[model samples]
Target: MEATPQAPSPLEETQRSGLALGLVVWVFSLLGVLGALYARWAWTPHSVTVEGASIQHLFDVILAIILVAFVLVHLLLGYFIVRYRARGSESALYFPHHTALEVTYTAVPAVVMVALSVAGILLWSRVHAAPPPDAFVVEVRGEQFGWSARYPGPDGKLGRVDNRIQRPFNVDPEDPAGRDDVTSPEIYLVVNRPNRILLRTRDVQHSFWVPAFRLKKDLLPGATTELVLTPTQRGEFDLACAELCGVGHYTMAGKVRVVTQQEFDRWLRQQGRR
Candidate 1:
């Protein structure tokens, strides 16, 4: 008769399980890192506004922190899983807790969060503080399935708009300031000049998003919102409605054209004639 076969030791089984789990964790973590890197390199849009650079910088800082923490935490977790696997007949160590470790973990995250909050607040203030005295102003109105832009004519003032009024562009027929208002299907901005965009909605909620400018503002029904940015480059960019309003949400799109001051003025004149 053949000699009786012996079963594998508990320690060997534990080692195999620990090694498998650790390998899985490490592999997934690596893949996640690679995917993030690829997306950042291939998908991030170019910054075309002064504020876009700052926004991108803040994003990079935040992403770096998150990726670092993610890698470190996973690395340590995998290491612990394999290093502390159960050994047969060995009692488990039960050193309840370490005060230093707990405090370090809590305090580090708290400090990091506070710092990030402060940075965000400062950036917000700068973005929405105030437009320059001579900043170019345009009004963007959102309706279901489309967007419209209104430029103040030579009057340099946007006429009063009332949602209650049933009229083209909702312009108050009584407000003389609106008479010269030129409405367009596209937005026109002057490169290298501060632009103040007034956002409004006709029926439901909508969001005005210009990816290249790194700005997104909501067009809330019955209310007005504002966004200010200075285009540093002159080019045509795509504008999108970043909200779901109705069945035709996907079709609500527009174009943003940044041109020289002279070109913008000439275009305004041409639009006013129409």
Candidate 2:
């Protein structure tokens, strides 16, 4: 009698099971993408919430393109691989690059990239442009594990601050700026005014990050850095220490309260008097 055709062995069966699992995972991933798209569409904030959220439209456009491209490419590749897997007497055919295909790929990506770059530059310029003449200035000082903020007391001029001459809570007697400029740990800002933060650190490198405003800047020891932000929303936001300093890094946090101009003035006066 002729030999019966051999059935797939246990090893082959196991291989098939793994392949099936991989396909199932890919399918679930696709479903997850759909769910994410729905969530993003439903949850995207129309009114900008943070400084970075001002460019939310641009970000959404870029993200949509990336997500769609990824899903399409993966699905097509997986389908082709499964449909054209190796079989007896069949071989794979490779095609050389076509100039039209190459040009289309390169030009499309180049255009998209250029558009994104231009949008980014425009947004950056808008964000960095000098504030209006009526903008407010607040001096921000970063130390080992805490943040202190100082506002110009009614004069709109920050008097002076020298770390070496100034004590923890006391101003120096000799230096003019130190004598006049006062520092306070409680930071208060007025709503509807452009605010500029002059950031400085005393001990080590630290980053002052405010998530609600989407503003962050690194404060270097012995040097001053600056950040300008406008709080459109009036509320409270937690300040996170973006950089690692030492043992208490995890506990280093601050509170930011955006209040009405009247409320801010009241608080400033109360804090400064003490």
Candidate 3:
């Protein structure tokens, strides 16, 4: 009797395979969730602007929703795969219709999408709204391999700029408003003060990005764009072009210095003198 042992049935083998695959999927899904959690907690950059915290919060909310959906989807998929695996002499079940299920899935996602869209629109409106009357103004010009900043001097008015003028800051030399404009290689912002930046490009398209500020705006050739922000921290941060313009794209880098109002004023005065 002991020597008459037989092979396992096909049904038993199929169940075992399904169970193993399901377990693998679950394990991988958990690992992915952990990795994302770790990245969110440890790798996220600090927000240094007044509006950056709100932006980060919105991003975190989106990520959390996505992760929740991801986990639920994978878990359900694994369960379905294991529960519905083919067995000997067994046929798959077919449903003629599932109205409630269909409506639930469709409505839930549609509602969520609409909610997120509204939130994004509100945030965008607030961020791009007209700058305060006393907001500091600066012009950021992008060129082939570098960045330059122009500040309105004592008159507090950025002069007319003609792309064809081809001068520093493109200031129309004849425009009286541009007579005291100050140009610099780096952008200087005043802490706790609203700053309005006018964006322009000399050639190809470029993007002005400051990670700490959580702000990025595209600079299109022959057109002007604007970005407004209020810095809450006083420090130097890296500014880089996010768009790839040409071979020298990687070399398009600059500095963003945030300082106290007094310091910013002194720096502007010194630059104007030079």
Q: Report lDDT (CA) for all predictions.
A: 0.91, 0.73, 0.90
lDDT of 1 by residue, 52-154 (tens): 8899889899999999999999999999888787767777778989999999999999999999999999998998888998999999889998988899989
Q: What is the C-alpha RMSD of each candidate to the true structure, in Å?
A: 2.0, 4.0, 2.4
The reply for model 1, stretches above 4 Å from the true place, is: 1-10
lDDT of 3 by residue, 1-274 (tens): 4786778788788889998999899999999999999988787679999888789888899999999999999999899988888677778889999999999999999999999999999998988899998998999999998898898989999899988997876789888989988888878888898999899999999999998888899999999999999999899998999999999999999999999989988888888666
**Candidate 3: misplaced stretches above 4 Å?**
1-9, 86-92
lDDT of 3: 0.90
Clashing pairs in 1: none
lDDT of 2 at 177: 48
lDDT of 2 by residue, 1-274 (tens): 9999999977567557656755875787698788878867775433323355766667778888888877877776666655554444556888887899999989998999999999989888887777676777887777778888867666666665566755653345564544445567777666667878888777888998875565578988777788777777787778878999888888879987778888977777776678
Better candidate number, 1 or 2, judged by lDDT: 1
Give every collision pair in model 3. Answer: none
Highest-TM-score candidate: 1
